[model samples]
Target chain A: MMESDINWNSIYEILTGPALWFTFIFFVGGLLIRLAFLFRLSRKKDRVIYNHFSLAWGLRSIFQWMIPWASASMRQQPVFSIVAFIFHLSLLAVPLFLSAHIVLWEEAFGVRLWSMPDGLSDGLTLIFIAAALFLIARRRIRPEVRILTSAWDYALLGITMLPFITGFLAYHQWGPYEVLLILHILFSQILLILIPTTKLGHMVLFFLTRAFIGFEMGGRRGARSW
Target chain B: MTSPTKKKFEFENNTDAPVDVDRVRAILNANDGARIRTWLSICSRCGLCAESCFVYVANDRDPRLSPAYKFSHTLGEMYRRKGKVDRAFLEKCYQIAWLQCTMCKRCSMYCPFGIDVATMIAVARSVCHSQGITPKQLAFFSDHCDKTGNHMGIPVEELVDTCEWMVEEVEDDYEGVTIPIDQPDAKYMYTVNPREPVYYPQDISYAAIIFAAAKESWTMPTFGWDCTNLPMFAGNRTLAGKQVKNVYDKAQELKAQHILITECGHAYRSMAFEGPYMAGYPDGKPPVKIKHYVQLLHEYLRDGRIQIDSDKKIKEPITYQDPCNVSRNGGLWEQARKIIPYIAEDFRDMAPNREHNHCCGGGGGIMPMGPDYKPYRMASGKLKADQIKATGAKFVITPCHNCFDQINDLSEEYDLGVKALSFKEIIVEAMIVPDHLKLECEK
Candidate 1:
């Protein structure tokens, strides 16, 4: 279909209406089900004596791991840690601080937070793209990482990077603005939908994994997980 | 590189035949739980866990031995197939789970997602146990523990006789020192690994001497004296539970306030942590408090209950090997570190001591897997051997029996030239027995 002939309003409605709500429902409902399933599994009833500083130690470990220099993994893989830190930081910052995203929040919830400048947003988007590419390259170049790299692992990376790439293109108006904008929204929706079921679930589940490990190892076992 | 001893445990000769595929599926299904499901789901296959594994590192970073690969090939495959895997595949899972990995849980520390790889391997082991595919030696020991209340099958008469012999042996060192047997309502019910009586009876003497010096009210029970639970290693949870129950019942019968475990890692972990759960006790709490010997020694040192002669320290440089169960899994690392300085003239720390220390490769029942797996176990301990060698210490003091045995093997195999001694041995050596307390030999 010709770009001009495309019904932009209808497309925006579909993307923001059914697609957005469907992905949100699936993402939330699927995560809840998975969590409930996990809880239903047989748990051995054991009263473990936790250390007095377990909570503090667990929180310390979580924060320590979030910093590249503070983690043991950083000593072994400094390059990966640096790139991953940037990628994770930008992953949260770029999307949350985008002017368009803030506007959407203002429209939907009547609350608006600070938004990043266009130039800063553009710079972060580029860094995010570069970080994703570096991760994919590392997986390919490193023999150890390469062997564990399944097709789905690559697919998850591609899916994660799509929204940023499309947003960049749409923001720069490199291609037809209407088409790129729709593509960005579509990719974002797809990502939201797939997250709960795929490795992307790590975004949400990482907290539980870290907290559980911290409590079990640091608190109960008196050992540091980090 | 199979040793001649390992040939005796030939898979073809095993009497407990492999179960059908359906049975394997059922076992896997039974083990399904939140922990397994979450771990299986969240691991991003980032390969960060690879560096933390000794086997993977010792094997020249072989992808096949990586913790991720081990999980994928065994538990991951089981999850994928929903337990409908064929016999050949099940057998492969048995080797990967039992022989390849030691279930040390070190990798979990490095994992950003904190996947409990060791527990998943335990689940895989449980599956193998259901199929009767465990190592023959492990099964034999578990059966021995079931029948004779010890891993080595030493009868009650021999156990009592051995305690009496140890008491007489220690009498030469200190006067008025006695090894009480079956003393009820004591403050501590002291238990030990069967290996003490079978192989190293002197270790028992050392513990007795330390207890006597501390003037602690401890007694050894004749019934459930074997604190080491082999079934916990063999993946027989039911039998593991029974063993824990036996010990609990014995302690309750003796009316001891505390169950004092010797310098054994797995025994302490299984009893103090896994025991209550295995015994089906409410909230998985044991009937009484459980304390490792290291904790007791630490308390004694802190409270001036036992006096260590700081001037009589060993001149040779000594290092400490953190036992996986006691240090990492049990959280008893600092206690041993605190006690080492008082006993040794010069103490060295391993590069990655404490929770991050590498496994001795003899854990998860690998030590009891016998001669057939000895070469494999020794080879996998290359990292541990290198860690010890780097310390350049004359002696390595480990508070756990398994680490001591494994470090001893690593020292011999790698020619590290380090003697592996228990914490009690070092403590006894540095302890000052007053002239008034020392017994003069009768001419």
Candidate 2:
């Protein structure tokens, strides 16, 4: 038992130290490089977009979409819209403000943002897990979504959900707690690496694309795209 | 409304011509720019775009017909394969790009990422175009536009003769009405779809009468009078640019303040919006200002250039079919809405009107795709038919010829007993002529 505990501790330390830092650098640096490359390419080949880039229109388009049910499209598919909002909000919030994650941030960088209370964090994590399951079920059962889904899409969903699952299990002290804690850290790092590299890159690319469409539809033509 | 007889196109399939794989690669490489690259990279396949597509809904929500699948299986596959795709693959891509989707851009609005699947479909069509695999009817019109300045191959003599003929028809209603041609320093250099001269010359007479009532100076360019760019719909960017440049040059030569486009949606979009980009203008704008007919009519009503007879206004329930290009892409939605109250007493809007309205299923040159696609076109138009039916409107006013024809066809096919009228038709029917411009017999 002592030896097993020591092994888990070393693994946890490694995941929380160099692995976490490496993942952070890769996530930020890689996305920045990719974004810069794409932005430059856009200016070079599609300079028409730049000639009519209106900040007011772009922000209006983005802002309208950010609000729940602000768009006709959102209203058309209310169930999916609500679930997506919840999923994305929880996805961003849990990682940034969960009390446990805040502890890591304070220890590593001597900085911390406001943290969610333990009860609220627990509630949000359950909602996140439910939303993830709903998304998976949607892909599995919804014919339109299923047809668009490939093995890679399902795998990405699994990768995204595993860290949260493992973390929840660890917090509840269910099963091998140390192993679950180490897996939660490792799975999260893996997700960070995959985000800037795979379809998960949409997390950042969505803003650019939304802004481009806004500029094209609204700025150039004076139509509200959202 | 008479349908133009389907012409037998020479290069319908062009199967004998060897598939130009190298040309396909070149075109794909050129079109795979930053916008397309980012769009392809970011599509999460959420399938939220599925429900927004009228075609998918009309076809009973088939997953295969979903916009996400349409773009992904075509352009996404080509990009994944690095444009080394074969003729059979190109044939499949052509089916999905041309037959399955209308590139109406409705899907883009629903996308959380704002993925312009229509743009991807257009790029897919362009790739197919390189391999000589375009819809034959569209290809025929495109070739005509490339060779002659008009899609129907109407020569300058025919257009001038049509203008003269339309002037005679209009003079019966308004004594001094004339369809002016190449009148220099005209405030508006007007343009029309080639179909106006070919099948619906009455459209010309209505415009002439409207201008006479408004006391506005407008002239049609005899050289580049055809404003519609069917070549752009065929994915022939070179021909599209050339066609737009023809109109632009004519407007510039005439020194017109605004190049007023007739009541055509795609023509307005091509001339005002996409054409300049395709023509590679530095500012991405036409040399002269481009105006749609809706905007002009709205201005005419607002400025009291023409008076509407309140008693002559149609009292039947009316609904408007918002052309995707004109309303959504061209930013003229409110202009049409403003015009409605002037001409109709009872106007009922469709459930999802304005920019969110479904395509009448004839956009992107689908109306010209000919008899081969009629059954599918009618089927896909089911969503629009239902939208119109729900409003229970007797008259459907759409300013676009494409929508006019499709809605008329839908009315007939669905037995909805509705009349599809262009705004020009409605306005001409209801507007009162000034006594000074009235004919002797009428006065």
Q: Write the per-residue lDDT of candidate 1 for residues A1-226, one digit (tens) a residue.
A: 5766879989989988877878778989987876666554534311232212256766776787898867686667888888999999999998888998999878866898899998999999999999999999988987778888899999989989999999999988999888889999999888888888887878767876777788778876778788
DockQ of each: 0.54, 0.71
| lDDT at position A17, candidate 1 | 84
Error of 1 at B443 (Å): 15
Candidate 2 lDDT by residue in tens digits, B68-179 = 8999999999989887888778877877887678888988888888888988898888888877788888888988988888899999988899889988776655788888
Per-residue lDDT value at A29 in model 2: 95
For model 1 the local lDDT of residue A38 reads 52
Residues forming the 10-long window of minimal summed lDDT in candidate 2 chain B: B1-10
Model 1 CA deviation exceeding 4 Å by range: A1-8, A36-58, B1-18, B440-443
Superposed model 2: Cα runs more than 4 Å off: A1-6, B1-11, B16-18, B441-443
Best candidate, lDDT: 2
Shift in Å, residue A7, candidate 1: 3.4
